[model samples]
Target: MRKVSTWEVLFVPLFFLLILYPILAILGNITLEGMVRTFNDPIFWDAVKNTLVTAFFAALLSVLMALGFAYFYIFHPGTIIYRIADFMNDLPIALPHTVAGLALLLAFGRNMFGFAGPTGLAFTLLAVVLAMFFVSYPLAARTIASSAEEIDREMISVARTLGDSPPQAYRRVVIPLLGEAIFSGFVLGFSRSISEFAAVIMFGGNVPGMTQVLASYVFTKVEEGEVSMAVTASAFCILISLLLVLFLRLEGKLHARSEKSA
Candidate 1:
């Protein structure tokens, strides 16, 4: 028989309560009135719509880019081309979002090739999506690549031997095996894009009714001393993010169980 210390049980819950009580206290204090007003606010809907749009497209683009890089890395691991692609995918992780934003702004801003196109990507919703993609693609790529590593090369070889072309093998074998990882990557990318601050602000210019996302809206509200509104918005964001992360984790677990059963 093992003996337990009296402090262990009390200490664990107490530690968590100490950390979580303040947040719950704040949430409790925020009224439904603030939430209702936040929803009714014109800027709120704009930020919500823009944030969803940006997150969706950025996630889609990041998933595609990650899929491509993952495929190359997995199937062509011995090639110098694959090595270079891996390096490029990994580069963004170390690169600060601000530096990336600055580089993007310089490339697309009015001073340079701004003459090349009448409406450059600079300061547009498109810029927001692209910037989000740039910052998020690496996370997706790494996730997908790790999943790809777990797939059986022998299965792919057998499929190829059975007259499946490369593309066919990928569709039938790789895609099925990678569904969880790809889904995980998309979720991660969307989460990153939604929570992002500096990159989108700098690259997309935080223009209200144009490029302003939820995070920027929160920032604008806080800067303008709209304390209640800002707190409401921040709380809403926190709730949504927590729900999403929980959903993604549940989905991942279910998928893993299904895979195991099969």
Candidate 2:
């Protein structure tokens, strides 16, 4: 283990405090009464449900796609091919989410899809999912790629030598070694989808009871002078995000313990 530096010890806490003060302030403003009242509203339920559903599917799709890209780049026969693939994987990360959403809208918009707009796509949910997926895939691919790079190639070879096929070696040996990375990638991608405001708002049209998500719903509330509701909604979003982070940490600890025992 490395020793903690003085600058790291001091600056890290300050950085977190800067990040957390707003969340704390938002939570502080919300009364329990306000939370209850907000919860009673059907719109609240709709927004929360949409947020979860969209983020879940978006992260699922992103992680699955990332696996193929990462695997190929990590084990490609030629260095140039892997480098090109790696650069392509990272290209989307550099794109602004809002820009990505606009591109999706243009590519799959009313003119293209031959419908009214995002609302009339052959599948209505496609717009939102594409928007979320566009911005999140890079995080997932990068996470898996980083983990794969650290793994000893000989371990994979040993599995192959034990009569495992190439695909079997990956499924049984590679995936288990990269479990933490996959989970972390899922968390990152999920968080990005949850926080997505500009992309979904633009591409999905921010429709109430339809395309509206938690972040957008909170923005709508604030714009409508529903400060109490907005604060409560923001609180819930923050709480859920924190819970997910806690779960990740706990799961990581269990994995560490199991590895130690092994």
Candidate 3:
């Protein structure tokens, strides 16, 4: 029989108490009326819509970029392309994302393009997408790469031996193996996107209608001392993000169970 340790039981619950208590305390400060009012506001609805659109597009773009990166990283190892892909995938994690925002702003600034955005502004949806993509890409790419590492090279060679084209082999043979990991990456990237504030605000300029994502909305509310609005917006964003992360964790458990059964 296995014995339970005192430190293990005590320490685990203590750890959760430390983390979860603060969140619960903050949430308790929000009255039901505050939530109701925030939901009924047109500005809140606009923020929600913008947040969803931006997060969806950001996750989509990140996954697409991650797939291409993982492909080259797996199939074309020990080359310049592979090194660059590897570096790019890890660079964002190693550095502050504000650098990416700064670089984008400089590259696509008003003076460079002499162009205005949708609301006759310098910052646009494109800037938000790029910033979110730059920050969240590592999650998808690294997750996919880890899965790709588990795949056998001989399986790929077998597909080529059967006269499958390179793209066909990737589509049929490689991507199928990468399914759960890719899904996990998408969820993580989405979670990251919805919670992203600093980079988006820095480069995207957070115009209320055009580029104002939920995180930016929440930040603006907080900065303006609109506590009710900030709490409500933050609560909704946290709920959505928690759901995504929960889904990813559940998928991991299911995958583990299946593997154990196998």
Candidate 4:
């Protein structure tokens, strides 16, 4: 065994503390009373329900879109459509949340689509889900595309040659190889949607029993000077994010184990 240098021992801890200590400290300060109060609050329950529902639907939609986009990119890498899709996928990451919200609002707001048309979508729960899906789909699609690029197209072609239909070849040959990455993308999209704030608030309009989510609710509480309530909600978001991250990590480990056994 060699003696560890002071710098080596301190480096990792310093980075973690710098990045995470404030959040941990804030969470630590929330009393059991604050937690219990939040739990019993109807608003809290409503927010929780809306958050979960939006995240679930948004993740599902995002993953589906990601799958289609990734497939197109993989199979038609040189096409103008693929190039355009790649450029659009890079937009969400580069865009400011408020700017994205405004752009979405402008496109979907009432009278823009048509007065008395399907414009109810602009300031409703559906808008929240749509915003979340758009924000997260690019992330999922990019991850899937990157993984798809690494796979051997020859195996898929061989499956096609051996009487496998396109769908069957994809299911048997491609999906299994890309399963871990796909699952990772799904979790990432879900987690990202759950924590969305500015876009969700702008698009969903914070209708308490309808569209209010954890982040927006927390912001509302903070604005009203309900510090404890805001802190409690923030803590809840942190907890959910941590849980999702743990699940994704466990999933990665399981996928690695399965691959090793194979």
Q: Cα-based RMSD of the predictions, in order?
A: 3.1, 3.7, 2.9, 2.3
| Per-residue C-alpha lDDT of model 4 across residues 53-76, encoded as one tens digit per residue | 999899889888888887777667
lDDT of 1 by residue, 96-202 (tens): 88888888888777667577565467888888998899889989999999989888899999999999988788888998889888999999999988988788998
**Which residue pairs show backbone clashes in model 3?**
none
Better of 3 and 4 by lDDT: 4
lDDT of 3 at 173: 93
Candidate 3 per-residue lDDT over residues 156-250, each given as its tens digit:
99999999887789899999989998888888888888877778887887888778888888888888888887888877877887788788888
Candidate 2's displacement at residue 180, Å, is 2.6
Clashing pairs in 4: none
lDDT for each candidate structure: 0.86, 0.82, 0.82, 0.85
Query: Which 10 consecutive residues of model 1 have the lowest summed lDDT?
Result: 111-120
Model 3 C-alpha lDDT versus the unseen true structure: 0.82
Full-model lDDT, candidate 4 = 0.85
Highest TM-score model number: 4
Off by over 4 Å in 1: 1-29, 111-119
